[model samples]
Target: MTRKLTTLLLAATMLLGAVSASHAVDFKIKGVWNMNFEYGSGGNFTERGRSVNGNKAAHVTGWGRYGEDQFEAKSRVRLQLDAVASESLSGTVYFEIGGVTWGRSSKGGALGADGSNVVKIKHSYLDWVVPQTNVKVRMGIQRVFLPDFTTEASQAFDADVAGIVASAPINDNLSLSAFWVRPYNDNWAGDTQSPQNYLDNFDIFGLSAPVRLDGVNVTPWAMLGMFGSNTFRKGDDFYGKNSTGAGALGLAPAVYALKDSKVGRQLADAYSTVLWAGITGEVVKFDPFRVAASFNYGAVDTGVEALNRKGWYSALLAEYKLDWGTPGIYGWYSSGDDDNIKNGSERMPNVEANNESTNAMSSFGTLGTWTLGRDTLIGSTFAGTWGVGARVKDVSFFDKLKQTFHVNILGGTNSPSMAKYIKGAKGVDGHTSFTPDTGTGSADFNSANYYGLYLTSQDYAAEFGVTTTYQIYDNLRMLVEANYIALWLDQSRGVWGGYTATDGSRVGGNSTTDAWNVNVSFIYKF
Candidate 1:
């Protein structure tokens, strides 16, 4: 009798353990892999090896120098894991590896393939619904993009940062969302006089309301930020030294002030305030025809007149869907500087991702080769410029093959005279005295090195591109893309021509050659 009882108890305990195990969280994994081959030329439009005042300036080259390599190859991989516990709770962690160039010894793309540290945590967040309520909250590091309908890319703010986002639905057609993000903190190690961690935090708060009606959707949003005095100080680990700090925000004017010893003393005890607002909407009342538009305005006040910045940006997109493809036209414009240095810049301020290869346009690079070509050569924000483009998207003639064609014309809105104030500005006598103390460095402000080509009223460019894709399998695809850009620069005294050599000579004569690139890619997802 005793032996039988003991056996029964053991069986009961085993069954209970099994039941608990079945109720535990479930894990799911998904990932993507991409490989690419590319060849291109003409990233630098400036004339190299010019002589200034009997002094021959060394031949300076820019990124993607005006030439070509046989061919370059690269690869990237991303994996995401999710832990789900019922419908009310879940957690996600996304990891990324590579985007490493082939044959790069540092990244372990060499023969041995033993890279030191190539893995990164792109995102890690937890989602949970309020107990007995419908409100949902996400907390952790994640992608944060502002509302944008026209280009599907926000011009003012779009990047990954640590924050808390909360959303609640008011009705079937309306919802509210809010977030608080901290982009920089504790980056400044206080000096001997100041205490550790003193006023070195940058924070942003934002809110948006999304509305949906019959065939109409719109969202209105606003954001406010507090920038500490020492948030971007020299020796800061978050952004590097003052000269190169805050580049992602396109805050060149402010950064220049912080870098200059004379100007830095004036803002020693001052902080800054930033504000932005925008509206994005789409009209799809007509089934096959749709229209989208967006307008945004932003401003930054650093308590100093020369460091303030304010401007606006607007864009429109219209498309018609056909049986075989979709055709669309798009345009955008943003305010630009007016050759004034003391009053600050009038161009729109924005936050861009540090990785230039990842900044792409939804209307342009329909495939993954957006960054592999010339799409963002004029800066991802499109500030200080205006453009018009047309595209035929997803044209299909075969079962699993599709193609797209694109053309765009771009022009600058900034005053041509502004060139004389930029860094490296040379006079007819080949003297650099024309350069201003506040906005001297081209790489410091909205220059070619930091952003893309900083165009003036006399500068323009035209772009043409083609993208073709073949679906090889349910989870794999191959793509080929080609892009070309024709550039024209005004070589007059008021434009780039003002930068003359010691003998009053302009290198490259009246014009420079164009730029082009071709890319091939294979992508797999599961």
Candidate 2:
């Protein structure tokens, strides 16, 4: 991705399509398939839960690591295509693959990389529309905008050649949304190719960028109206460092000869920058008060900051949705960027110049772009599904029994030095991307901090379900539903391990260090 980074991403997508332009572009490019054709029978969940593999401040320096019972998938298939979008312009082709005759899976959660059957091209792009004020913008190799709902995990999943966006709506209250991304932070879907690689820092916050088939993102934005986004760039790409673990380097081996030097990827291990701006609408509507805020100065290494590497970082976030019940209550906060004595200041590293004397937080910080579980929140949770992974009849596999207790999920643990134990991160043995505190944990069921990160959640997320019947015959009935989640941590990571304990006799966590992930899925709906 170099041709001057592809001409500064097409001059930042035509200067954001010359700003404030949008009108006629009806929009509709269909064909997005989702398949899960199940038959019957199920059983698996030993380490099935806290798979906490890597990313999310992996494991501060013992470099994060995870490997257990993997090789599963009963039935699945997916296909993507746009085949249509109406005026101005649009195009598509998104590939998909699952199951394996060649990609074969004995069973654990199957997809295939060597189990055979793995195909990719995920997305391609093209878009244009600027005649009035409808803001129809679309740029190449896209999709990297952390819009709510913790999808499979976080750590500020980065992505690039990017730009996620919106603009157009001055009347329904307000309008505008954003992304100026720069990802390629390696992982490409993980589980293969390891021999000491190390490229993952164009920071797109929290991993996972799959929205190809020619890029295009839209969000006319409304409600009191205010939105802002920023993704930065500087260069050098050694990417955050937790150092020490698996092939240990633990700082001082002259930091691997300055990452094998050439002024460490040009002028001391360069990472980049992004700045965000915000203002959201709807400040009083019957029972509403919606607002958003952003103030940023950039320098990112993904998932909050992961040890600053090169230099500088800054951030802020806000949310207030009060109307009570249904969908309300979401709080946010962000602030990163600490490192002065800039531009080639003493050749970077050294825990990124000791994170400029500590404010301690940025193992992929948290708040929007959701770094990594600062409380994996879910709003008023409830769930359902059945056959074909059924999405509702009672949620997830037609139910015969169920239970509830207002839900919200995602667990906690991160913040020790900056997590990220190990796995891919540009081919393993890179000793994780730092941030300590057992590099985030879960798979057991503990720390739920008022329910989030991972206490228990299903039915999309943030749950509340209840099913009870005991008919026995006729059509048949006999069920039990009892699922409750509320695990928590940040009891202040045992209050900063007794302030970096010298021996006040705190010995930092491990009564199995509180981890959580609830389970209860029993079914038979006929």
Candidate 3:
């Protein structure tokens, strides 16, 4: 089935390309393939998964469990087709074949685990340039936006959704873009037991305008997003009326209705609205200096009758080029949850789950570096955290070999106090716990908490690391990195236990006080 689908898609795409080319319209086909090799000292360097919060032990586990010398390889391929239909219209089809695992399958075969590979249509859209106007409309599945600079240290605002985007050039120096985006709606609308019940119907709208001034460009943007099914909420009563008519005996109709309300309320509280503004520009057109900065603030209105959700983030980056290389520095700060789900005057939810205040740093494939320090120390900058780093690029001794070097230091405190949220937990040895009222009972509030189970670790922890990449060719490179981290688990002692502390002083449970890691990656791109 997989092979047949791949053949059919490729055949159809090729046929379209041939026919479109014969029409005299511009048609182009391009692709990129990257082969990656990874080796890590504790085997932890190659671990893959979304970050789990508050799990200090999970973060500290050395990859040695995988093996003393761990090595893994993977490949990715992307194909893009561009066809210009007319003077004012064109279309694009971009597909990405990902998760093509290599080596032995789960059953010990050479191919891979059963059905472990998958393909995705990352972007497929039609572009229509309105006649006699500067407006253009793009409709279909597409990326939210691709920034001109880089998403190395922050990517919290990026998303790919099926939607429509419109852009208008107000003048030669100014332009505006807006988007109304959402993913496909699900079919389990009336199925109470389906996991789809908890999935919200996400509606997102965004507007941004860029103003170019001489050598500098400024973009002011705002996004309004909501998740909930106006349809599902209304169908609550309908389903409730038919309980047991066509559904399983244990799955009551009210369960579906309640799930809708609970999921909607949680999502609303998780990320109600987001507003941010930013500017990007060069210091001198003739010189190699550039800067970009942005600030974002938002709130989660859980409407849970007890909790409040709110968080904000800010970041800045600057770079300069000299005779040898380009040097850059970046820093960011994001609010963390200062209080667990407390009630009354204490109901504070900084950087709430739905608030979307996390900062997206670079990733392995996206930025060519694994977040060793970030993952070990703070999991992700999306929670309450701050960090600064310096990077130098393109240092070359010979024309064929160039190097890029980076060093970053980061710190963070736990958000939402996982201990307070969970039962049967006493305070960490160093931190204080809050027992404020939880007010009304909403569906566990677990939906609003992304942090993991109670783990011993300090609130104020620090991590630092250095990484270097040697580019053997323009499209081929080798990367290596080493990281060190020390967590401040003892908030009471004013310092998390240092290398000398024992489990008695750690929070939640026995957590590592200090950890070290090393990793290397060989990449080839075409």
Candidate 2 segments exceeding 4 Å error:
1-114, 124-126, 130-134, 137-361, 364-510, 513-526
Model 1 pairs in collision = 53-502
For each candidate in turn, the TM-score is 0.83, 0.23, 0.69
Best by TM-score: 1
Least accurate stretch of 10 residues (summed lDDT) in model 3? 245-254
- Answer with 2 or 3, whichever has the higher TM-score: 3
lDDT of 2 at 142: 51
How far off is residue 253 in model 3, in Å? 27
Cα-based lDDT for every prediction: 0.66, 0.25, 0.46
Number of colliding residue pairs in model 1: 1
Better of 1 and 3 by TM-score: 1
Candidates sorted by TM-score, best first: 1, 3, 2
Model 1 CA deviation exceeding 4 Å by range: 1-23, 45-70, 235-241, 254-261, 264-269, 353-375, 426-449, 498-513
The sequence of per-residue lDDT tens digits that candidate 2 reaches over residues 1-526 is 1243245347445534543255333323233222222111111111212222222232222101111212211232333444233666665444434322222343213353333324444456666677755776666665443332211111122232444444344444344444444433443222233222233333332221222121222121111111111111123322211121100110111122123233222212232332222222222233332322221112222222222222221122222333221223222222211222121211111111111111111111112111111111221110000001111122232333322112323322122221111111111233222122233442111111111122111112222223333444444344333222222223233222212322232323321122222212122223
Query: How far out, in Å, is residue 220 in model 3?
Result: 1.0
Error of 1 at 388 (Å): 1.0
**In model 3, how many backbone clashes occur?**
19
Of the two candidates 2 and 3, the one with more favorable lDDT, higher being better, is: 3
